[model samples]
Target: MEVAGPSFLLLILLLLAPLSVHSTPPPYLSPAIFAADYDDMLESFRIFVYGARRTFKFKSEAESLFLASLLGSPFVTENPSEAHLFFVPFDGDLSERSVARVVRDIRADLPYWNRTLGADHFYASCDGIGFGSDRNLLELKKNSVQLSCFPGSGGRFVPHKDVALLPAGVAPAGEGEPRGLSSNETIEHLAYARLGAIKDPGLVHRLGGDPGLLIESEPSDRETFERRLAMSEFCLFDYGGDVSWIGDAMRFGCVPVVITDRPIQDLPLIDVLRWQEMAVFVGSGGGAEGVKRALRGMARERVERMRGSCVAASRHFAWNRPPQPLDAFHMVVYQLWLRRHTIRYARRDWS
Candidate 1:
């Protein structure tokens, strides 16, 4: 999800040769997860999940699923000495002091911290609040992978060092099932929201007048929501924090249209996938006119190609139990694998 311009696509193309195969294959071969090599480290790479059991438990079912996926993976190790990486799982509800206490205890009890200065140690927490408050924890996190759904910028989330954790969502298709495009829905633009920024009178007055664009301020049931999204060629997503809709739109075969002024860094698969090829981006300041202009600019063939790409990429965003090859869980692991070289520990000290 690290934000870069079109040049990123070139980098992806160049690096495609090395990042195209998963560490573990066959019994768990998934192309989506198979893209970068960690210098064969993944073949023997092991992670030790430290911290108390209670500290790792999450209130959110989705967050808990992420932990379950990691614990069930083959790369986890029972002994710290066998680990290439360390994980301290903390939930969103835990306080800064609680997180700090866990890190302090781990530093004292484990030799790994002193050897690497905690560079190889990482943590996963869904919430961003209270993470920046602790100086010691902040310093440690800066050197390690801080996985989270909100990979917001500023402090601990250095794009090159951290990983963007996608929210847990239902898979678009079952294993071996065909991913069919939506044919019933015929709407061109479908948006359901109450945000004032999106509903600006001047902008809405322009785009709303068109029958092709539909914006409903009223809330709808899940069934209705899915139907609207499925029918539309483009689904409008606000610049708001919640990005659950991006996955939903892809699931239903609607190309995502992100409306934001700032550069987007935390978009799912931004590091691997060519987002400009799949999703439409419009500046918030451009108003509804911007949205209309973007849509107008796209030819029919181009829109279809984008939708095809969305369907192809949807499987990577899925949440599967037991963690399939390139499912959401593996994608998170892949992100970590991509950053393996960024945090290096002293070899002689560890040896």
Candidate 2:
């Protein structure tokens, strides 16, 4: 599972569109795995979720089903997997050591009737389960898994290219927390500044323009942002000499002008967004100048169409089916559930 996440024009130079670069991946598709779609044998076991009082950050899908059953829940499209017990976040309604009891019973293999009664297991959450995650789990996860599919209406929360499909939770800023980089004071703002915006002549000589413009009233407002972005009739996403701010432009609805020298695999959402069709990604580094010219010469409708496609690209990632693999909370549930299976059936004793 993967997920990935922009830009300005100083015009005139826009007439020359920046050079093209490496290629990108295909469009995003939906996830195929689900409990409902599981085989009959795997759907028999009941799960007990211990997310009572919303005390824990993560819980299992099985538990959700169990709690719903306890409430005498009516049919959801009927014949949906009646996978016994499922727990949901109780929000102070259910309390005590209910979770401890469940973990104990599961570890004891209490539900496995001669190894035929225990149900096949599955767990989902933003968090990781340590049970089966023994091998890869040990590998340090250097990067955080960002669930960009659900932006939840946070102000200044620049959305990724595939956020359009998820239900937009209207929780206002600071009301609820999202798994994102914390901002103690300074914003770790990412930018795609062109050489034309710099101060020193040497900088302009080294990077893209006039040094004076960098000194003169810098363009930092929304208007300037939009203008620079709209400069070239067609944009080139110069992922540049580094990780380009392609995600930022998409947040603003500008078709990312991706020009990369490296494989687009380095970026997630590469599979879902159809980066090539929507972006002017240059495959050959030397051909960049030519591609920029072609981009600058492109018709207005083509550019706008690409912009629309960028937004359309967003429709792929939904809540359950996020743009990336998993969220922090879900990861936790998976880890715990695997632990249950291991201790109960696999006879693996982990401290």
TM-score of predicted model 2? 0.35
Residue 57 of model 1: what lDDT?
64
lDDT (tens digit, per residue) of candidate 2 on 1-351: 111210112222221222221112212232122212211112233344433233333233323322343233121112213333233232222222442233335445444322322223222222222222322221111111212222112221122211111222212222222111123322112123443222334433432332212212235775665444433223333442312223334333345445445544323343333465566654544453444455556676565556455433332221222212222222222222322332243423222
TM-score of each: 0.76, 0.35
Worst 10 residues of 2 by lDDT: 1-10
Q: What lDDT is obtained when candidate 1 is compared to the true structure?
A: 0.62
Task: Provide the clashing-pair count of each candidate structure.
Answer: 6, 46
Residue-level lDDT tens digits of model 1 in 1-351: 121122433423433322111111111123334433422334556678875345366645556777787786777888876677888777667777777877778777877777766677777765543345576576566666777564354443565666767766454346323132434435545443333425355665676677777766644676676666566778776655345656666666678787777777776666667788678888988777777788778897777666666656666777787666556776677667666534455567665
